[model samples]
Structures are given as structure tokens and as C-alpha cells.
Target chain A: MPKETVSLRQAACTFVMFLFGSSVIMGVNSEAGQDSWISLLLAMLMALPIILIYARIMRLYPEMDLFEIVEKVIGKIGGKIVTILMIWYALHLCALVIRDFSEFIKVTVLTETPQLNIMLILILVVVYMSKSGIETMGKWSVIILPVITLVVIFTMILGLERIDPTNLLPIMGHSLGTIAGGAYKIFAFPFAETVVFLCLAGSLRKKDSPYKLFTVATLIATVIFLLVIMRNLLLLGPAVTNAKYYPSYTAVRIINVGDFLVRIEGSTALNFILAGVIKTTVCLVAASKGITRLFGLCNYKHIVFPLGLLAVALGTLLYENIKEAFDFLEIYQIYAIPFQIIIPVFIWILAEIKVRQDKAANGSHSPDSAQTDAAG
Target chain B: MNKKGKCFIIVLLMLFLLCGCQGYRGLDEMVIVTGIAIDKTPENDNYRLTFEIVDLTVPVKEMGLKGQVIESEGKTLFDAVRNAKKRITKKLYFGQAQIIIVSQEIARNEDVGIIIDWFLRDVECRETMCFIISQEETAREMFEIEALTHPLVSTEINNILELDQEVTSTTLCVELYKAFGGLHSEGEELALPVIHKAINNGKTVGETNGMAVFKDNKLVGFLPPNESKYYLFAIDEVKGGILTLSAFGEEHNISLEIFENKTGASFDYKDGKVKVTVKTDTTVYLGEVMRPYAPMDEKEINELEDIAKSELKKNISNSIKKVQSEFGADIYGFGNMIYKKDIKLWKQLAENWEEHFRTLEVEVESEIEIANTASLK
Candidate 1:
């Protein structure tokens, strides 16, 4: 089968939506209270180096995906072992996102509707999307990102009249340690979770710079993140924002524009579903590719359905209730450290060493050595 | 068709047929709950829950669109809510519920935070629903009284409280989330609107009588309608209201319409004495010059401003003193203001805030600006 490719713009759009999928609903650094936005800004800065490492790894082997690159850099046996771990991480992350969406729907809107049914329908859409391949996901992201952005912007404007500027006072109310802790919590879940995109980075069109795409996507996601946190803080006040489970939804519920446009918080559910579908679909596609490469399969499409079913089952087993689901988030930040930070940095260091050695062997000190190396 | 296409079509058909609209309910199958009232029953010590369900058959233009009020008693709120199913055929839907009326009994005995937890936890409940405390013996009595303007008593009360921001600051529009916030915050208090059945123009009607103040979870005291406006002004929540200034010589009742307000609170602690300064900036329009409108010169305008300013200061100080001395409750949120200004100071004061508030010296400063005089001038 021929390889699929997508434009850097589409990649950036998909990346932003992916980061926004769960973070927008879960809220960022709520422990910081009124200073949550400050923590978000710090988290973005903390995430930059990790994102750059992922981008550097992608540039080292232009055509090879994460699975192929792992196999090439490490030996065949070690590569297969690493490929299995990557597949498990992708599948686990996908299920967690699915669980977050399903649990949120169950708690907020669909009380009588069974969570399993919600997960099933969502996974069905994800399966169909992943089967269409990476290029279609890119195009889907570009089309949906603007509409989602417009809805969020419109909601924020409508909520402006209700916000109290004094709620944002006492800017650095929290100590530096508390703020840093809050940044670490947010960094692992949304920002560092961008490591999954390394598998799909190989699918970007040949001329696009992965660094530019990743940076642009992170910046867009960070701005949206700031707006969402600020809206919650201003409209709900610090006391209420920290109390509610979904502060954005609760804040938007109070938007009374002449009382006719009240109860528009349902738009929050729309934002969640759109971004969640993109994020889950990307995870499934990346996992399927890893599984296919591990087993020497010719095509990844055949594995998408089975892996998606596994994701549904895993989501159901992730937690018993919403409280437990949230309890898992703190543990998730710690658990994701190995996959998101440690492994990627290790791989980037190895790739840099390999690139320099190749340049040394060829006696070529040109800046275009990576391109020549890829051609070889 | 290809096998994949055929499978896709079959699965789609199965989804539509098998799922059967998971969370959807037909209009006839569900009854819309317009308002809810909770009171403790005398006999069983259980909760007496009254649901004001909207009767859809009545025309919108009808004079008395009598809604059905279902009553049930149970050990818990959800139990009582579910027990109502025995009386009504359809499930009670709360998405349209506009008001939650807590009786004086519940406000006195039960925690307001606990009473509102069921509403906040329910998926069908909107966070914007207004929370009110009924002045009558039982909240059900308030619902039983016929509404003067609207068919549903809750609707009439909701409209009146919404308009109360402009007419008077007597009734506070406390949303569900805001009430929860007040209950959850340390050293903060919840002030809710009080609804009562009153005789208005020879007919009984639902009236927003005054304000109910809660120190923690239980009702601490009541603020009369006259003083509630001052409380709102002290909090900078005076959207629009009328202030009758009579401090001038010979009791000249000049009605000033409040158009704008800005409140600033500061605290000073010296040797265990706390001094709280509340500064208020009020911009008003000359609504009425009862003494036969005279062409006001600059000197007269300044005199009017002075009278208005002193009156505002007096009203605010009286209200603060009433809440502090009578109730020993810091509903003015002086502690919360200190928390915002200086967290460390607040940390030390939060433990004995109520006691500290009682003896704390309060200073009121009002800057009144008559922004506009009526066209009659």
C-alpha cells in the first residue's frame, strides 16, 4: 500500500485539537485556584523542550515512523520490544480519552444512557475515521478546528458581561512551589502527551518542518487553553471554579443574554466530542501502525477494528465512577513520565549521536547531512 | 454491494434499532418541574418535597394556568423525589426548573448546602436556577398561593427577582453555583432572597419580602427590605435602586435613582482590634425632587450631593451594625476581602472572624455623584 501524507497546516490543526481533547474538559491546574492561568503559561514553557526533542527525533529519520525508527536505531529484538510498549501506550491513551468523554457525557447530559453505549458509538466513529487513514484525519481536523474555535470564541464573548474583573486579582496568590506543582500536573496530561504524534509525524508532507508544525500547534492550543481557564476563573470566581467538576461547562451555563440565550453550556459538549474524536482516531491509527510494523504486516487498516474494540473494553475497566476516573489523573501524570519524557529524550540523544557519526564517516560537514543520510 | 459496504449498512441499521434513543424521552412521557420546595415534615421527620410541575395543556394566554404540585415524603431528598413517581405517571424533569424554594424550617434546621447538593449533583438541573427561602411556615404554602401575574408562582417570583435588580436590591438573585460557592468558601456567607405570600391590593400574591442571611449553612438572621439595599450597595452589587435621602433640614424626601456603584473594602489590624473601612462610590439620577422642583444652582446641587452622601454613609453603617450586632454574622464578606488583599492576614483572622467582626470598628465613606437630573428639570 502507498504511504499517506498530509500538509503541515493540517498536521498543526489536528495537533491542537488533540491536545485540547481532554484538557479543556478536565480543566488545567485547578489547585492553583485564581492562579490557574499562570500555571498553564508555565506548563507551556515546560513542554517546549520535550516537544522539540520529539520533533528532532522525527527529523533524524525523515521517512521512518516511530516504530521503524526504533527498530533501526535499536537492534531488531530491542526495537520490537520498544514497538510493543509504544502500541500499549497508544492504546491506553486512546481508551483514557474515550473514558473521559463517556464519563463526562454520562454525568452531565446522558444520565440514563449507559456509559458502555456511549463508548461504543464513539469508538465506532473513531474506527471508521482511522480506517480512512491519516490524510483524511488531517483534512477532517482542518475543517473542524475553525468551527470549534469560532464556537468557543462566541461563548467567551457572550460570557463576558457576567465576568467580574476582581476575580482575577491577587495574581500570584500561590507560592512558587504550588504554581510549579500545578504546571507539572498540566504538563504531563496535555502537553507532554503530544509524544504520540511522533508516530504520525512521518506522514507529514516531505517539505514540511515537523518543528514548525509542532510549535505552531502547541502555541494555538496554549492560547485556547488560557482563554478557557480565564473564562472559568472570571465567570465562576475562584471559589466556584475550584469546586465544580467541569468549570467551563458550569461557567457557560450562567450566560444570560437577555435570558433568551441562556443554558448554552451544551456547546461545551460539542467541543468535547469533536476534539475527542480527532484525538482518539489519531491514537487508534498510530497504535494500528505500531502493531502492523511489529508483526511485519503489509497493511495497518486490517488491525484498526480489533484494536478499537480493545480500547472500548479498556475504557470500561479504567475506572468505576467519575471520582475514580479523576483520581487516576494524578497517577496518570506520574505514570506517563517514562513514555512522555524519558523514552523520547533517550531516543533523541541516540539519533543525534547516529547523525553525527554518519556525518563523520562520510567526511561531509554539510548542513544537509540528514537528507543525504535519509537518501542512503 | 461489497462485503464491507454490506456490513457497514447492517451495523448502522442495528445501531438505530438496537439503541432505541438512549437518553431521549417523549414529551408526553416526562413532566417538566418548574420549581421545587423542601420542608421537614412534622410527623415522620422526613422531608416533605413539593414539585411544581408545569401543566402543558393550559394555553399560554390563559389567566390561571394551574400547575400540578405533587407532594411526597421520604428519608432523603432523592428518595422523596423518586417517591413522587408513585403519584405522577411521568418522570419528573428538572431541566426547566427555575427556582428552588427552601422553607424557613429547612433554613433553620437543615444545612442549606446539603439541601442544594441534590440539585447540583443531578444531571438534569441547571446551575443557573435561582435559590430562594420562603418566609411562610412551609415552602409549599408559597407555591399554593396564586400568582398575580403568571400562572406558575415560581415564574412570577423569578421574573420579580430578575427585575428586583433595577427596582430594589431587597431580593438577591442567588444562582445555584453562587450559593454553593458561598457555602464552600471560608469566612464567606450566603445571602438569598426571601419569598413570601402577601396580601397585595386585596389579593394574595407572591412577594420577594427581604433577604435571608446564612453564616455557614444554616440561616443566621433576616435583613429587612429597607436594609437589604444598603447591603447590596456595600457589596457593589447595586445595579439600579432607589435611595430616599431625608437627612436634609425639615426632612426633604429626595429620591435618588442609583445608576452605578463601586465598593472598596480595606482592613486594618492593630493590637487585636480590627478596623474595616468600606468606601462606596454611588452615581445616581435625580429621580424625584418632592419639594416642587426648583431650578438647582451649583450650590444647591452640592448641598443635595452632601445630603445624599451622608444618607448613604448612614444607611451602610446601620446595615453593617445590624448584621454584626444582631446576628454576629459577617455577611459583608470583610474576611473574604481581607483574604483577597492579604492572604496571611486572612489566615490569622479566619479562625475567629465572627467574633472579630462583632467588635470590629466599621467606617463608611460614600461619594455620591448626581450624574443626571430628570427631564422635568
Candidate 2:
């Protein structure tokens, strides 16, 4: 298999773009108040230790990719079980992301276009991205990264005119418990999506270490998340911001530059679609690789098309409608923790334990060949 | 390697080709409705939906200043809208539409909640438009009447609603989206601006001063144009308006052009008692005094200030009581205020909001500044 190399800059850009797609504003703002930005900050901090588990796994298996480490650590039956769980998790996440993107498109761009049609169009892009491999998807991260930055900057700038500073007052107006609660749902999205990147950690230019790379990505996503929540809060104030759907988008719409640049509300929606596509591309590529490694396939591209179709079907049936989808997130988020954090940590633990035991039992295991062992 | 990649590329190319011929029809194809009026048919059983659709390409200047409205009658508002399809070639698009006016006759009779839910759910319907109740005339007539100026009459109507913020505290600038919030909210009743025709010569006029009051979503009665002004101010909608007062020897008509005004209510809950304080801060431009406060005496100005405060306070209390008793609707959003200020009070008063609001003592305090005297001073 050809090893791919993605730059640190590509990883940051892709993370920023992916956060834009994962309903960052929709997840935190609708329930959390104008202080949703605070929730996001807290959630990112909360998810840090969990993020470090993956970092530790990458540290332990510096030379091995996610699939390689799983096999080396869990030993066949256990490894395959973990690999299958991860594959299912990625597939489900890819489905959710696809659902969010298609639902957005259905509500914003193509109201008459059936949900299935939107999912189909989105799935086509995801499949093409997956088939093209990490090298090409990383190229997308590089391409979409700048566009996303411009969008965030422009939206924040335009949205500034409506900023009533009073909305920011009485900091931590949300009950401590409520704020604490929203943080986890908010954290699972952009923060947890970082877990999938472990599959491509080895593909990053060797010996550079993923520590700086993952940290940079998290920071970039955090900043965008912060700006979106702040802009929405300041524009609509506390209560109205919570009542609205796509608050960030409407906040942008409120950006009337002398009435000429009016109603570009859907621009954020466009940015989300573009960002979501890239994120799905990365995840799709990772999921395909996970499957290929588990099946011992020489190439992963063959799985991309079939999995892409499955993603479309899954998105189409994820929930009955947009409101229900977010409602499900409020409760069903409890179910996502194991996939995003637990499974990865489990792999990391088993990998580290086996590595330590193997090294202790056979101090010169690699250097001592069978001939040397028998001769001794 | 090249052959395999090329085959992949060729397949993608074929797919792109398959999707290439699809084209976007311009948003213009959909009728851009600016205002919608739901009125009961004269026969009273059917529905009359009047659409104030502005065709951008056709200049209003050419139409002698009147915008076009397509009227359709059916059993339901949706039916009326769909029936209009037969008359116009363009598809009806509600995205840019800003005003939804419900005729009082129908508003009093029908479930505005059900009618509004359709607009709320529709993707294209604009959320920030003014929601109104037709005072006396059919809303269809209001849609047909030409405004004094402005190509799009509804835009002018919306401007009036926006500008009313200075003179009045309660400009029911609440849109469909806000209306939905007020409905789903714990203890709030809905309110919509009331519109009526003020006739001059022998002609039918649709633009006039008056607002309909509703208990929940049903129209209960109408507020006089003056109360509408005070209510707008009470609700912080006062953009600017004139204040007229009379004394024994002097007639004081102060054109109080308000620049900035803030209306906020504080709900304080205690043992066996719940009270709401309605406070307003207004900056006003004083106008020409009929009897000479000659050099515009500070005493006279102070007197005028006191008068303005008392009048505003009286108006607010009266307005509150009328709404509470007549319609039992909390249009002023005391529920929302309490929800923000005291969530526990909101929970207690969430049910029977109107009754609780009526029973709850309302104390009104206002600070008015005579920012400037007309240049005549």
C-alpha cells in the first residue's frame, strides 16, 4: 500500500472545515443560550483528556496506523472485534454527517428536492472523495480551508453590526448544571470527530509527531466554534437566538450592508455543505481503510462505492425530520460517547499493555531470529 | 495504472454528464409575495386569501403606483393560495414576503394558530414580516389599496410599523417566527397589529390607525390609534410620535419625536403577591407650545415632562387592563420578561397567564427627556 503524507496545515484546515459542518452552532446555541460559546469552550476543555488518549495511542504506536496497531495489540479475534466496532462507528458517523448536510440542503437550497435526492448527491461527492484516497481528500482540506476561513471572517464581520454588547452580560447566566450538560453534546461533534484521524496519523509525514498536529486542529476548530456562537448571540440576543434554527445563518442574514448584500443568509449554509463534504471525505476514506485492513484487502478504493451507497441510505432514514434529528441528539448523545471516546481508548489501552508485556517477555524479540533462539 | 484511473475518471465523467443538463429556474419564476391577508369570504363560510405580490421586472411606476394582488377563494387559506395558481404564471414564493394580515372577522372566528403553523413550517415564507389584523375592511381591500408613495406598498406599511417604535411602546412588529415563540413559550399569548381603512372623500381607504387585540390567537377587539402609539412606546417600539396634552389656560401639543426608548418589565414574586414593573426610558424632542412657555421655561418643560410621564403611565395601565380583560392576551410579553428576569415566577404564572397578568399589579414608571425644542424656540 502507498503511504500518504498530509501536512500539518492540511490537518488544521480540515478540522476547521469539519467543525463548520457538524452543526456546531445548531448543537450548542439552540439549547445553551448566548453563553453557548462558553459551553463550547468548556466542552473542548472537557474533551481534552479524552483527546489525549488517542494522542497516547499515536505516541505508543508511532510507526503503525490505527488498523495496524489494532491488529498488533488485540491479537486476531479481539482486534477484529474492535476493528468492526470502529468501522461501524465511522459508518454511522458518516451517515449522521451526511444527514446533517442533506437536511440543510433540503431546507435551504432545494426544498422541493426530496430528502433522498439530496442524500444521493451528497453521497456521490463522499464516494468520489473516498475513492480518490487520503492524498486527494487532504487536497480538499487544503482547498476548503481558506474558503471556510473567509466565510467565518466575513460572517463574523457582517454580523458585528448587529452586536448588542448587552447580550454578553451577566456571564454564565445559564445554570452551572445546564452549561455542564450541554458541553458533552457539544463536545462529541467536532472534538470527538478527531478520533478518526488516528487512522491517518501514520500517513502524516513521518517523525513529525501528531501531538502538534492534533492540538493545532483542535485550536482551529475551537476558534471557529467560538466566533459562530458569539456572532449569533450578539446579533439575536439571548432568547431569540435559542428559538431560531440555523442561528448563525440568520445572524449572517441580519448582515444587511446597506440592504444590497442582504439575504446572503444561505452563505453559511453553503459553507457548511462544503465543509461537511470535506469532513465526510476524510471519514469515508478512514472508514474504507479500516474495512480494507480488517478484510485484508490489497486496495480500499473497491469498498468506497458500496459504502457510499450505504451512507446515503442511512442518512435518508436517520430521522423523520430536522427537528427530530436535533431532539435525538439531545438524548442519543449518551450513545455516541462509547464510539468516539471509549472504543479508541480501549484500543489504545490494549495496544500499550501488549507492547509493554511483549517487550518485557522478549527483551531482544525482533533482533533474536528463530535461528539465534534455537542456537542459544 | 493509467487505464484503471482513466476508467474511474471516465465513469465520473459519464455521471457528471448525466447531471449536467439540469438547470436552476430563477427565483423570479416564483411569485414574490410581499403581504398576505386572510379574510373570510363575504358569504362567511369560504376563505379569501389576498396576496400582495410584487413583480420586480414590472415597474410600479408604470402601474400608476398600485401593486398587484391575486385574490383566490376556497374552503381553506391553502386552497385559496393554490387556486391563485390558475391566474398567474409564476409560482407563489413567500420568501421575501414580510406581512401577514388577518382580517378581524376571520381572526376572531378561526384558529390563527393553525393557519400560521402552515406559514411557519413552509421553508420560503419570510419570518420577520409584520402580522396584522384587519380592523374593519377585508384584508383583500388593504392589499389592493395604493399607498401614498413607495413602489411596494407593503414595504411602506412595514416602515410605518418599524418607525412606530419611537412614538409607541407596542408596535406589534412581532413576526411569524416571534409569534411562534410566543405561542410555544410557557405563558405568553399572541398579539398582532390591527389595520383599518381611514376614508377621506368618497373612496375606500385601507391605511389607517388602529390595532386589533386578541386573546390567544382570536381577535377580541381593537385599540384606538393613540393607544397603539402609547403601547408601542410601552413595548419600546416608539420610534417617534406626537404627544398632545391640555391644561386650563393652555393647549400643549408636544411633538415627542423619540430617538431612543427602552421598555422592560420586572416581575418580583413574594409571599402571596406577584407584581410586574413596566419601566420606560424615552428621549424626546419637544415641539412648539401653543401658549408661550415663551422662552420655553424649565418649569413649563418640567410640567410637560410630568404630563408626558403620567399620560404614558396611564395609557400603559389602561392598555394592559383592556388587553387583560377584553382578550386576556399578554401581547406586551410580560411572560417573556418574567421568563428572562425570574424563571420561577414564569413557571407559577405560565398557566392562566392572562388571569395572572390581570391580577398581578402593574406599576409603570417612565423617564422622559425633552431632548430639543422645535427651532421656533
Candidate 3:
């Protein structure tokens, strides 16, 4: 089969959708009260350097995914150890997002539907998308991103009348410590979670600049996050925004224009499901690649079904109820650190050192000299 | 079979699974509730809920739809709501409910936060529904009164409250979300419209007049309809209302219809005391003149404007004083204004804000412009 590659625009769109996956429904960290927007802005600033490092790692290993790069950079045995960890991270992240989406659907729209049913239906779609390969997923992202963006912009415009600007007053009322803590939560969950893109970066065309893709996508997602946070805060006020489980849905429920444009939250629910599909599919594909590389399988697509089923099972058994699902979010921020921060940063440093050494050795030899880089 | 044919069959099967047949309910299987009224049972502390369900049996050819009231009792609001299943054959769907009426007894005695928890937490209940406190003996009585304008008393009350924006600004329309916000916020209080039975043209009807003010989650006092308008003026919510002035004499009154109004409340803190200055700018058109003649010179119009401004200033000040001395609730968001102005001062005054509000000095200033006399003048 021909190698699958996605254009730079499709990659960026996928990145944006992935960032919006669970964050849109869960909303930003409300511990900062009315200052949640400030927390989001701070999170964006902190995420910039880390995402740049991710882009740098992908650029160093031009056509190799994270799992392949790990084996090459570190010896095979150590690389296998890291690969297992990455596989767990990818699979767990996939299950977490699936659980978030299913819980939202159960709590909001389909109250009587069992969560297992929701997860099964969602995982089936995700597995199909994963089996279709990265090119198809990219194209799907390109088509769905605009619909999600339009829904968000439309809701914001209609919600303007209900928003009370005064709700944003008393800015920075919370202590700096509290605001920083909120910003850290925002950074760990949504922003740093974009590190999953490295697993699929190998599918980008040779001409596509990973740096530009990650930067532009992160910036766009940050702006959307700010608008959504401010909209929720203004529409529901700080107190209600903090108290509700899903602030965005509750905020959009209040948008009644001339009483004719009511119940537009259905559109919001659709956006959540669509974005969630892209997110879960990315995680499933990444995990499938990890498993194939670990076990020496001929193709990753062979295991996408079994892996997706595993994710569905994990998602179903992860939480007891909606409250437990939300309570897991706090632990998730801390739990995500090793996969999102440490391992990526470590791999990026090793790749940079190896690249500079390879350049030095090549510079010392003639143009016709034999290539000694076994990883290449 | 070819791959394409097999793939098509699989896709068709998946489509059937995705329809979510488990939670599906046909429209005919459920009865839509337009409004709900909650009152305490006469015998015990259990909740008695009255649901005004839309009567689906009414033919579309009829001018207006009819409503059927279903009453249930239980230990809690949700229990009472679920107990309603014993009375009605179809399931009670609350997604379209437009209003929730709480008896004055419930608002005065119970912690409103507890009463509304089910409405806010329940996924089926909408947060946009308007909340009104029924001044009648029981909230269910408000639903039993005659529905003159609409077949359902709930619909009638919802229409009257909506029309209040254009006709009379005497009543406050507080949605469930807004009440929740007020209950949770430290610097603000909740105020909802008061509904009661009234005689209109020899027929009984529900009327929304005045507002029920709450200190925290419990109702503390009531503002009369006339004073409610002034309360709206103080809070800058007076969209359209009549301002009558007897400048010529007690018998000859001039009524000015408000066209546009803007009220700005500023705070001045000195020596630990907070002073609020409410400035109102209004434009009005001469609506009616009870005098014998309709003609009025420019000088007379200017004098009339001055009289209207002073009267407005006096009424607004009086209403603020009434709320301050009687309820001591910061329904006007004076505390919120200070909090927004200076966080440090607000933090210091946050505790015991109601006590501070009771003694807070307020000054009222008004500027009125008589745009033009009506076609009569």
C-alpha cells in the first residue's frame, strides 16, 4: 500500500479539533471564578514552548512517529519499555475522552440510555475512522472543523444579549496562587494533551512545517477557548458557571432570541460529538501504531478494532457515575504529566542530540561517503 | 460477496444501532408540561406539586389550547413530580415548561435554594423557565384561576410577564438561572414577580403585580406595583412605563410615556461609609393631558418636564429607602458595584454587607427630556 500523508492544512484542522475535544464540553478551569479567562490566557502562554518542543521533535525525525523514534533513539529493549508506556497513555487517553463524551450525552440528552451503549456506538465510529488511515481522518477533520467553528460563532453571537459584562468585573479577585493552579489545570488537560499529535506527525507531507502547524493550531484553539470561557462566564455569571457540571451547555440553553431561536444547545451537543470522534480516532490510531511497532505486526490497521474495543471497555468501567467522571479530571491533570510532559521532553532532547551528531559526522565525510546512521 | 457490498451491509447495520432506540419515546407517549406550581401540603411538610399539562385532546381547530392540571404529593419536589405518574396516563415532559410558580409560604419559610435544586440539577428541566412567587394562599390556586387571555393560566401568566416589558415595568421577570445566580452570588439578591388572583371585567384572572424580594434564599419583603416601577428605574430596567406628574394641579395630571431610559449608579467611599449616586436620563413623549385643552406652549412643556424629573427623583429615592430600611437586601446590586469598584474594600465589607447596606446613603439625580407632545398636542 502507498504511504498515507496529510496536507499541512488538514493537520492543523485535526490539531484544533483534538484540542477542542473534551475541553469544549467540560469548559475551562472555573476555580479562578470570573478570572477563568485569565487562566486560559496564562495556559496558552505556558503551552507555547512545550508545543514548540513537540514540533521540534517531529521535525528532527521527519517521517518517523514517536514509537519508531523511541526505538531508534534509545536501544531496542529500553525503547520497548517506553513504547508500552506510550501505548498505555494513548489507550487511556482515548478511553478518558470516550468516557467524557458518553457521560455528557447520558447526563444531558439521553438520560435513560445506558453509558455502555453510548460508548459502544462511539468506539465503533472511532475504530472505523482509525482503520481508514490518517489521510481520511485528515480530510474528515477539514470538513468538520468549519461546522464546529460556525456553531461556536453563531452561539456566541446569539448569546450576546444575555451576557452581562458586569459578570467579568472584580477581575483577579482570587489570589494569584488560585489563578495559577487553574491555569496549570487548563495547561495539563487540553493544551499539553496535544502531544498526542506527535504519534500522527509521521503522516504529514515532507513540505509541511510541523512548527507552523502546531503554532497556528494552538493559537486558534486558544482564542476559541477564550471566547467560550468568556461567553459562559458572562451568560451564567461566575457563581452559576462554577456550580454547574457543564457550563457551556447551560449557558447556551439561556440563549433565547425573540423566543424563536430557543433550544440551540442541540447544535452544541452535535459539535461535542463530532469533535470527540476526531479526538478518540487520533488516540486509537496512535495506540494501534504503538501496538503494531511493539509486537512486530505488518500493519497497524489489523489491531484497530481490538484496541478500540479495549478502549470502550475501559471507558465504561472507568467511573461509577457522572460525579466520579468529574472527580477523575483533577487526578487526570496530575496523571497526564508523565506522558504529556516528561516522556516527550526526554525524547525531543535525545532526537536533537542525535541529529546534531549525525550532521557533524556527515560534514566530516566526503559527498560519496557511506551513510553510517543505522536509525535513518 | 464483493467488498463494496459487504461494506454497505455493515454500514446499514451500524445505522440501525446509532438511532438510540433505547431512549426514544414517541410524541404521543408523553404529555408536555407548560408550567408547574409548588406549594406545601396542608397536613405535612411534604411538597405538593401542580403541573399544568397541555391538553392534547383539544382539537387544532379550536382557537386556543386547553390545559389539564395534575396534582401530586411527596416528600420532595422530584418525588412529587414523579408521583404525578399515578394521575396521568402519559409521561410528564418538562422540556417545554415556561414558568415555575412557588407559593409565598414556600418562599418565605423554606430555603429557596433547596426548592429549586431539582429544577437546576435535573437534565430534563430547562434553566430558562421564568420563576414567579404566587401571592395566593397556595401556588396551585394561581393555576386554578380563570384563564381569560389564554386557555392555560400558565401561558397567560407567561404572556403577561413578557408583555410587561412593553406595557408595564412594574413586575420583575426572573428566570431560574438568574435566581440561581443571585442565590449563589454574595453581592446580589434575588427578586421575582409576584402573581395573584385579580378581577378583570367581572372575570377572574391571574395578574403579575409588584415583586417578591429575597434576602439570600428566603423571601423577606414585597414591593408594591407602583414602587416596583421605581425599583426598576433605580436598577435601570425600566424599558417602557408611564410617569404621571400633576404639575398644573392635583386634578390636572400629565402622563408621559417613557421612550428611552438609562440609569447609572456610581459609588463613593469615604471614612468607611459607602455612598451611592444613581443618575437617571430619560426621554419621554407627552402621552396624555387630563386638562381641558390639548394645547401647551414651549414654556409649559419645560415646566412639565421639570415636574416629571423631580417626581421621578423623589419616587426613586423613596423606593431605594424602602428597600434599605425594610428588607435590607442588596437587590439593586449596590454591594456588587462596590465589589467591582474596589476589591479590597469589598473584601472588608463582604461580611455584614446587609447591615452596611441598611445604613448606606444614596442620592438620586434625574434628567428628563420631553421629546414631543403626542398627536393631540
- Tell me chain A's TM-score in each of the predictions: 0.96, 0.92, 0.95
Per-model TM-score, in order, reads 0.95, 0.85, 0.97
Docking class of 2: incorrect
lDDT of 3 at B348: 94
Lowest summed lDDT window (length 10), candidate 1 chain A: A367-376
At residue A50, give the lDDT of candidate 1. 92
Best by DockQ: 3
Write one digit per residue (lDDT tens) for candidate 2, span B189-299.
666776666665665445646666666667777778767776666566566666666642555545566667788767778885678788998777876566635677678
The CA-based lDDT of model 2 is what?
0.72
Q: Candidate 2 at A105: error in angstroms?
A: 1.4
Worst 10 residues of 3 chain A by lDDT: A367-376
Candidate 1 vs candidate 3: the TM-score winner is 3
Tell me the tens digit of each residue's lDDT in model 1 across B206-283. 888879988768898788789898898888778888888773465757888888888888889899788989999989
Q: What digit string (tens of lDDT, one per residue) describes model 1 on residues A283-306? A: 999899999998889999999999
Q: Interface RMSD of every candidate?
A: 1.8, 4.4, 1.0
Q: Model 2 compared with the native: what TM-score?
A: 0.85
Q: State the lDDT of candidate 3 residue by residue for A1-376, as single tens digits.
A: 4678999999999999999999888848458989999999998899999999998787777767888888878879979999999899999999999999999998898888888888998898899899999999999999999999888889999999888999998899889998888998899879999888888877987557788999999999998888888888889999888888889899899899998999899988999999999999999999998999899998899999999999998988898888998887789889989998999999988877776676678785632112223222
Report the TM-score for the A-chain of model 3.
Answer: 0.95
Please give the fraction of native interface contacts (Cα pairs under 8 Å between A and B) kept by each candidate: 0.67, 0.06, 0.83
